[model samples]
Target chain A: MLIEAAHKPHERLGAYLKDEMAAVNALISQRMASKNAPRIPEVTAHLVDAGGKRLRPMLTLAAAKLCGYRGPYHIHLAATVEFIHTATLLHDDVVDESGQRRGRPTANLLWDNKSSVLVGDYLFSRSFQLMVETGNLRVLDILANASATIAEGEVLQLTAAQDLATDEAIYLQVVRGKTAALFSAATEVGGVIAGAGEAQVKALFGYGDALGVSFQIVDDLLDFTGGDAIGKNIGDDFRERKLTLPLIKAIAKADAEERAFWTRTIEKGRQQDGDLDHALALMHQHGALEDTRADAMVWADKAKAALAVLPDDPIRDMLHDIADYVVARIS
Target chain B: MLIEAAHKPHERLGAYLKDEMAAVNALISQRMASKNAPRIPEVTAHLVDAGGKRLRPMLTLAAAKLCGYRGPYHIHLAATVEFIHTATLLHDDVVDESGQRRGRPTANLLWDNKSSVLVGDYLFSRSFQLMVETGNLRVLDILANASATIAEGEVLQLTAAQDLATDEAIYLQVVRGKTAALFSAATEVGGVIAGAGEAQVKALFGYGDALGVSFQIVDDLLDFTGGDAIGKNIGDDFRERKLTLPLIKAIAKADAEERAFWTRTIEKGRQQDGDLDHALALMHQHGALEDTRADAMVWADKAKAALAVLPDDPIRDMLHDIADYVVARIS
Candidate 1:
């Protein structure tokens, strides 16, 4: 399955799309600047320079290159996607009161929530400006809808994150909104910009959607079993009372006593010193972790399968591997 | 000026553009809904339903009507402007840690900052969707730039709000960004959509820019002397340590003792009894309040003068009156 590889899929894709990514990075730096507001550039550079893998923008570039088109607008669209992502991350840190991101102190921590919120807003507006410069209404439509979906998904999560009634269906909807919407939009806009056929564009959207879902499930899973390699504190989501896949699955299969335990710890927000360990034990007892991993694998497979309609390009191979690598962390 | 009459200028414009304003209100209600996240609508409705005069959207409608625009997209643009304003207000409340707005409890205070931030983001995305539906690139560019400027202004205010070094020039730049940018965009887009000539569009932009500057100057003045008709607490800006136009003027004219008082109260954040009254006395001592009012009158005159290039229509007259009424609040 080529899943035994030691190197990262994104790094390989980054290498392949190095030139386009370099253009995207330059555009990002250029657009993030404000002639009047120096604070905008300051706050933005702190997050943009923090050195996360530029995966989303790369997805856009990969889709464009794979679609057999050469154009300048792809760089604009790639920068747009990255700007949207950075904006969302800045706002997300404020929403979650997160102190750290990508192994560094968050922008909200370094500058203040006001800076984070306002700078995030500036980036969102700047992204719109970049997308509008493409002069493609379809791309704008896809991105605008994806953005609305992303915000809606966030608000949905705000309400449903701790509710026990949030089943797999609601969780999937939330995941699609917050994470998958932008991912799918990134790929779909790239194909649309390249004047790809309807079938290929749809395929790109499908691939990104499935990959995003797989990506988020794995993220949630790693919050439990990721140890130090994930760069997030283990059980951080548990402490936040988030209804991730494993915990939801465990709760679904809980017996009376286990149900009481879940209700007390999660719903009531009454956690003791060893509650996280006990929650892990319960997830193991219910095989919830394995079931969650299986679900991520299914989504990853679907992501790979969606690429069958696209042309057989090297970029496509990397995209396929990216899907596998997203879930391979759980293996 | 016709603004000397009993009725307010905005009320007159509202009556003039009543039908178009109705459509904008309906569209706003329709677009603000989140089919999945009920919380979004709840938070949005709290702010939308609060009777805040809806002046920005009215400006768009007035500009379009003055340009003889009969198309439906003007309504869309008006609603777009309103949604953008509401979104910014929501975020501003969260950034300011504000407890009340427009004589009502703020969305942040009522729902929570998380809801305010997310809902604000949702509305911003929705505004983009609405503007994109118009299929006008120029409109998109103006609105997008305005949005970026608004955020930049807010961030600038975050840093400059309390600093004694903030001068009249920086204050004007900040005002042009936060307030005048939107006002000019609202009017410029209307002219662009209505097929107004380049001269007319530029004139509309100039008029809105001047009127907005005057409007904001009067608002700053009212924060000190407003007898409760302004729907905000007197000295609220002072309490928040905002370096408004009046305060900037007073700071400019401060002597040794007055400079020490300004430093102690504003820069050092040490407020004691009678500080508000003492600050007002100093402003009076320097004739800063009168000078600020004179500056507002000059801008309002400039706004009226800019309208001289446009068609001599009733809507144009109303806009001229709006410029007068904005400063008349201080009279």
Candidate 2:
């Protein structure tokens, strides 16, 4: 496991697709430039230049290349996906009132929320312009629907915040909104743009959807167990009262006293210093973390299984490896 | 002017297009709903229900109908325009740090800036979905370009704020971003969806663009003169340090002492009680407001002249009146 961790599947994928990824980076820099508003580029460069792992755009390039896409528009689609992701991150920081991201001061902190909001809108518009340049209405439709899903999921998550009634269904919905919709769209558009068969497109979409769900589940779990791996302190989600997978699972199993504790800490935002440890203990008592990990493994497996209908290629193997790597983080 | 103001041309346009506008409203209300995110509807309804002039959507409907379009998609186009307008307004309130809009507490104030930003994005995505329903790439292209222009104009406005160097050219660019881009997009998409001739579409775009410029010039002029008619206090722009047309024109003609006052009051934002009056006096002394009015008249005339290429319909006449009525607000 240690040897495997030294060179992750995603890193391997990135190295394999290095040339294509560079094109996406070039396109992102080119499109993010605002000829008049220097601040637009400034704010964008602050975030886009931040080490975002480029996982989402890599998913696009991989999906297209895996499906034998040879056109220039995979670059366009890859850049479009990154813009949407970056734009969302900008707004998410403002929405979450975050101070730092990826070990750097957030654009909202360095600049202000106003610049973040306006620049985010600019990037989204630029994404729209990029997609429209493809002139593929079906691609447009898939992306448009995905955009709506993402926004709806965000709104759903906001309204559900701190409500003890948030269950697995709501958790899944929020998960999809926060991550999966874009992943699925990134892959689906790649296949559609490549003129792949409907079955292959569906497989790609399914692969991305399950992979995103698994990725986020691992993120949530790592918040409790992986210490510094999640990029911050353990129990940040607990402090923020996000009812992610493990918490929801544990809460579903809570007894009367345990329910009271959750209500006090999460529902009322009255988190005490030792509360995270207590929550972790309760999750263990209920095996909630184990259950959540189990669920994530299932999703990772589903993601791998979804790719079975696609062509046999090294890109396909890397995508399969990415799915395996997602669950492997928490394994 | 008093006789003409008894029933505004916009009111006439609304009356003539009432049924179609009703359809637009219904579509807006229906699409603004979220199955999962109730806050979206809450924030949207707050601004969407605020007694906005509904002028932008009406431009779309009028343009399409005047071009002899009888399809149901015009309703979609009109609703798309409104969603874009509402979304921009929500973000604008956040950007301006505004407390109230149209005498109602803004969405950002009523709920929070987080909800405002997310809901605004939801509405934007919703607008994209609605435009895609038309299955017209040209319409999408026009709206996408306009969206970019609007965001760019806004970023430009942000960077240009309180800078005495902002000229009439920059002011016009900002005006186009803040108001005219959407206006022109609203009209242009309407014509495009109707499959109108290129000449007619160009005329429609020209009309909306000029009218929006005229409307905003009147709005800026009113901020200096029309106490409360703009739904806020006079000199609000002055207090906000916005360099509108009148201010830009007056700044160019400022004497040494007047430049000091302008610098201290606007650039430094160190306005005293009598600063607004001094600013107004300076504007009058230089005929700044008069020149701005002259500029508004030219755009209004241009708006009217653009309609000359269109078929002679009552909708066109009312559109012409809407232009005349805009300048009449300040004349």
Candidate 3:
């Protein structure tokens, strides 16, 4: 394999679509700037500059390119997706009252929650304006529907947290909203904007949806698996009392003694030291980690399979590899 | 005057559009609900049931009726405007950390800020979905731009507060964002969806814009005028350090000692028991309240003037009446 191709799937895709990605970056900067509220650009530039691989925008660019798109509006749509993503992060930080994100202080921490909330609203408006500039009613419809689903999912997650009754179905719904809604919309709109056939759009949507699910599942697994490379401390989820898939599975199969332990720690949120070891042991004994990993593999496979109907280009190949790489880190 | 015409303009318009307003209310209740997140509806219900004038949604119905529209989408657009307004209220409560709105506890106060933020987001998305269903890109464009303006105006308000330098222009911008943008969008979309002529749509926009600014300026004047009838305590704005038109005018004409007093109380926020009374006295001494009330009249007249191009129906007459009633409370 060529050395260039051996880099991570996103990196390779980033290298291949360097110019388009650069255009996306430029559009993000230009759009995030405000003529009136300097606080807007101040808060946004902090998050935008903290850079989370630009994965969502790249998904938009890659999907558009895969369908032979050469339009300028893809850049707008790409930036639009990023703005929505950034807006969500700002609000999420405020909702979580998080102090750090991507190894830096969160916007909510740097400014007050008021700035975070108001700036998030401004970014959402900016994203709406950008997508409207495309003048594609279909694109607008897709994004509008996705936004509802995403927000609904956030609310679901907020209510579902630390609840023992939350099942796998609720978990899937939350994952789709909090993570996958924008991902699927990001890619699906790219194909639609390119005037691709309905089948191609469906395939793009499937690819993005599956990839997003797999990405989130792997992320959840890493919280238990101890993601030192990613700098996420182990048991952070346990300490936060979040009900991830593995914990859900473990809770489902807990014996009376284990049930009491889960109740005190997960439900009651009275976590103690060394409880992390016991939780990990329970997850391992229940095969929750293995099942979650298997679930991730299944989704990654589904993502790769969805690409078969699309045009077979280098971008397509990168997209295919992206599925494997999304699961590869956990392996 | 007819008995109905003698009623408050909003109530008169509400009675006139009773059937359509019922439909709009039904749509709002239906859409604010969440199938998965019970918290969304729970929080939304607390606010939606608060029973404000529903003046914003009424504008949509009246504008559409005046334009001779008979479509089902007017109901949808009316509901959309209300959702956007409600969403703003939710977020505004969070930003203001306000305990009460429209004489009831705010959602952020009843629930937490997290619920306020997320539920507000859900409403915004639901509003987006409702508008997209209209299938009118022009309507979408108008609303999208309005959302951005409203949000940007909010950020401007956040930074402009407690600062003596916030001029009338800045106050107008903030008022437009927080109040006028949605009002104008509500009317403009109503006209556009009704297939009204461009001139009529422009007039509707102008009317909503001027009426909103007038309405807000009058609200500011009432704060210092001791609006006991409205249940708002005198000097609420003074305590909040909000740079309303009267405050801005007073600050603009302050002497050196008066400037020092403003710098101490308003900017430094070291307010005491007599500060509000003193603030009112200064406003009165400087003729700030009179000038502010005069400014409100100017905008209200402008709102009434913009109706010349529209059809001279009862709805049109009510809209004209509304511009007066908005300032009538202070007078």
Question: How does each model score on TM-score?
Answer: 0.98, 0.98, 0.97
| Runs in model 1 lying further than 4 Å from the true structure | A3-6, A228-230, B4-6, B228-230
Candidate 2: residue A302 Cα off by (Å) = 0.6
Point out where model 2 deviates above 4 Å: A1-3, A228-230, B1-3, B227-230
Pairs that collide, model 1: none
Which lDDT tens digits does candidate 1 get at residues B1-331? 5664657888988998889999999999999998899999899998899868898999999888899998999999999999999999999988998887887989988888888889999999999999999999999999988988888888889989779999999999889977999999999999999999999999999998999999899988988888545458889899889999999999999989999999999998899999999999999998999999999999999999999999998888888888888887887
Candidate 1's DockQ is: 0.86
Expressed as tens digits, the lDDT of each residue in A280-322 for candidate 3 is: 9999999999999999999999999999999989999999988
RMSD of 2: 1.5
Clashes of 3: 0
The lDDT values for all models are 0.91, 0.91, 0.90
The total of clashing pairs for model 1 equals: 0
**Candidate 3 — which residues are off by over 4 angstroms?**
A1-6, A228-231, B1-6, B228-231
lDDT of 3 at A102: 86
Per-residue lDDT of model 1, residues A1-331, tens digit only:
5665556778888998888888999999999998878888888898889878888999999999999878899999999999999999989988999878888888888888899899999999999999999999999999999999999999999999778888999899899988899899999998999999999999999999999999999999999997436348899999999999999999999889998888888889999999999999999999999999999999999999999999998899989989988887888
Model 3 over residues B35-138: C-alpha lDDT tens digits?
Answer: 88999989988888987889998999899889999889999999999999999999998898877888888888778999999999999999999998998989
Predict model 2's lDDT versus the native.
Answer: 0.91
Output the lDDT of residue A4, model 1.
Answer: 55
Candidate 2 clashes between residue pairs 3 or more apart in a chain or in different chains: none
